[model samples]
Target: MHDGAVDLKAEARARIYAQPIEMLDPAQPELFATDAMWPIFERLRAEDPVHWVEAPDYGGYWSITGWNDIMAVDSNHQTFSSADGITLQSLESKAETARRGARPSFISMDPPRHDEQRKTVSPVVAPSNLTVMAPVIRERAGQILDGLPIGEEFDWVEHVSKELTAMTLATLFDFPQEERRLLPHWSDMITNAPGHGPVESWEHKRREIDAMVARFTQMWNDRVNAPPAGDLISMLAHGESTRNMDKAEYAGNLGLLIIGGNDTTRNTISGSVYALNKNPGQYRRLREDPSLIPSMVSETIRWQTPLAHMARTATADCELGGKTIKAGDRVVMWYVSGNRDASMVEDPDSYLIERARPRQHMSFGFGIHRCVGNRLAELQLTIIWEEIMKRFPSIDLVAEPDRTHSIFVKGYESLPVMIPSRN
Candidate 1:
C-alpha cells in the first residue's frame, strides 16, 4: 500500500511538473497525507513564489511558498486578518462551522481583542513556569521511557508520544489524569476531515464537539466556583477577560488550548523517531553526544512542519513576492514549504541534528500570534530525548507509519517500533 501510494505520487508529480505554471493547484490534501507535496512545493518556490492555486473543491487561494514571503504575511497581521479563518478548507465548511456554533478564539481575532484574551493563559507557559516544570517533565519522561516494552514492537505514537503529551496537557489543565486521552481525541475530532480517521461524517464530528464543549463547560463551572489556581481551566475561569466569554467563545478557546497543547508537540515526538531512523548518521551523532538533543528537537520540528499551513484573508490589496493580492483573497502561508526552501535553509531536505542555527525555522510561526506553548513543546521534546538516551540503546522502526489524512495537521496515526534493551 505504501509503495502504491508512492508510485501514484510519482505519477502525480510528473503530471504536475509538466503542467504550465498557471495550471498548478497545490491545495489538495492527498499531497500532504502521502508525503508527496515536496516536489509541488519545490516547483512553486522556484517558479512562482506567490502561486495562485484554483482547486475544484476549495476554490482559488494564494499559496505563499517562500520563507521570506511567509514571514511577511505572518508578521503583517493587520493586512491579513486571521478572523476570516485559517485553513484552505472549502467556504461551505466555514459556513458549517458557524452553523454548528463554533466560536472564534483569540487566534482568529485581530489585535486588541486577540492580545486581551491571549494574556489570560500566557503565564502558564511562561519561561518562569517552564523552568519550574522542567524537572517534573524530565521525571515523567523517565517514567514513560522506563515502561516501554524492551525488544518488542509497539505503537510508539500511542505508548510514548501521545502518552507523554497527554500527561503534560493534563498537568497544564489540572484535568483528571485518567481522562487525559480525551484531550487529544477532541483535538483529532476538531481537525479531522469528514470520512477520515475517527470522523465518519459532519454530524459525527459535531456530536463529538458538542460533548467536548459540555465536558469543558462543566469543568469551567467547577473551576469558577473554587479558589483561583494555575491550571488553564482555572486561569480562564478566574481571568478578568476570559471569565465572561460566551459559550461559543469558551468552546473555541478550549479547542485552541487543546490543539496547541496536543498536536504540535505530539507529532514532533513521533517525527523525531522517524527522522532519526531515516538519518542514521544524525542518530549516531546524537548517540555520541547527547548534548545535541536540543538541536535535534528543533531540527525535527523543522523537518516535520507539524501544522502544514495557516490561512489568512487579505484585509487590503497588497503586493507580495512579485504578486498583487487583492482584498479578501485567501492567502495561505505553507510553513511546510518554507521549512524546506533551499534558499533559506542549508540542505533543507536533510535532517541534521547539528545545524548551526537549528532554531531558525518557522514551525511555531511569528510575531504576536506566535504559539503560546512553544517553550513547553520544546522542553518536552528535549526531556524525552534525554530520558530515551539514558534508557534504550536504540529504537528501531518496524514499519512505515500510518499518517493522518489531513493537510492542516501533519501527524502520524501510528508508528510501530521496537526498543533494544540496554545491557
Candidate 2:
C-alpha cells in the first residue's frame, strides 16, 4: 500500500489516465515501426481501445485503438472534428507563437463550411469521373512497364511506383509532365513524419511547402485567364466555388491533392511488389488467375494501410469506452489497429487475396473522410499489376526492404526488386 495511493488497480488506471499523449514526432519515421509500438497497439486494442498518449512536447491526444472505436469516432464527426487539423497538430499549432496562418482546406474544416468546401471538388472525384480517367491511367502504366530495366536491379519505389503515380496525377491535374516531380517533393515536405526523413524542423519545411503553395497561386491565376478543358485545375479555376477560393485555400487544396495522390497510391504499388515477392503462395495465386488483381489490390491496402492514422479534435467533453475525453482534446483514429481487429477481420494478420468480403478493410478510411481518390488508387494498382503480369510472371525482391518509420503514411523507403526480362 503506497502512501496516498488508491487501490492498485485504481492507481494503475489513474496513472494511465493521467499520462500525457505520446507525441509521434513528424521528424522521425522509425517511432511507428518499433517492435515496442506494435505490441503496445495489440494490448491497447485488447484492453484499452481508447488509450491516452502522454506527449508533453507535442501535447497530448487520445489514441482510438480498435476497429469499432475508430469507426465510432469517424462516423460522429460532429464530436470528433477535423477542422482543427488532420494530424495531431496543424502547421499553425506546431509553429512558434510568432508564426501561424489560417487553415488551408476542407480536409480540416467542419460542418456547413466543410460541406460547402467539399462540394466544390466532389464531382471531379466521383465514380463516373474515375471511369473516364481509367484509360489514361492504364496507358501510362503500360509505358512505365515498357521502360523498366530488363534484367537489372532497380528501385521499384522510385522508378515504377513514384513515377507512375506522379505522371498519372499530373495527367489528372493537367500539369506539365516535366514538373511532375515537384508533386512528390512538396508532399514529402508537407507530411514529413517527424524523425522519418531529412526534414529537421517543421517551420523550415512549412516555408518550403508555402512556397509550393505560391506556385499553385500562379497556376490558379494563369488558369483563370485561360483554363484548360477536362482538367481539375481548369474546373477549379472556372467553377463556381473553387473559383472563389482565396489564394491560400486554393493552394492548400492543391497541396492536399498532390499529397493524397502521390504518396498513398505510389506506396501501395511499391508495397504490393514487396508483398508478392515475400508471399510466394499468394503471389502464385494472383499470377495464375489475373482476375485476382482487384482482390490483390484490396489485400495490399490492408497489409500496408498507408496513412496509418488521422486525428480529430473533440468538440465537447464526453465519455468513450468508460473514459472521459475533454473538449478540444485531440483524438487519433488508428486505422492500422482497426484493420487488424480480430472481430472485424478473420485471421487479421494473414494476407489473403481471396479473402471473403475483401473490400472491408479501413485502408481508405470510413464514413465522410473516406478517400475521394479511392477508385483512382484502385485503378492505378490494378493497372500496374496487369502490366506486371503481362511483362514478367515473377518479381524477386533482392534487398531486405525497409519501411518508413511513420505513424502515418506506411510504406517502403527502399524496395529493390529483380524483374526478369522477357527480352
TM-score: which candidate is best?
1
Model 2: CA > 4 A from native: 1-28, 33-36, 90-93, 96-102, 193-204
Q: Which clashing pairs does model 1 show? A: none
Clashes of 1: 0
Residue 309 displacement in candidate 1 (angstroms): 0.8
By lDDT, who's the top model here?
Answer: 1
Task: List RMSD in Å for every model shown.
Answer: 1.5, 6.9
Runs of candidate 1 with Cα error greater than 4 angstroms are 1-6
208-284, model 1: which lDDT tens digit per residue?
99999999899999999999999999999999988999998998888899999999999999999999998889899
lDDT of each: 0.90, 0.77
Candidate 1 local lDDT, residue 167: 93
lDDT of 2 at 353: 90
Model 1, global lDDT:
0.90
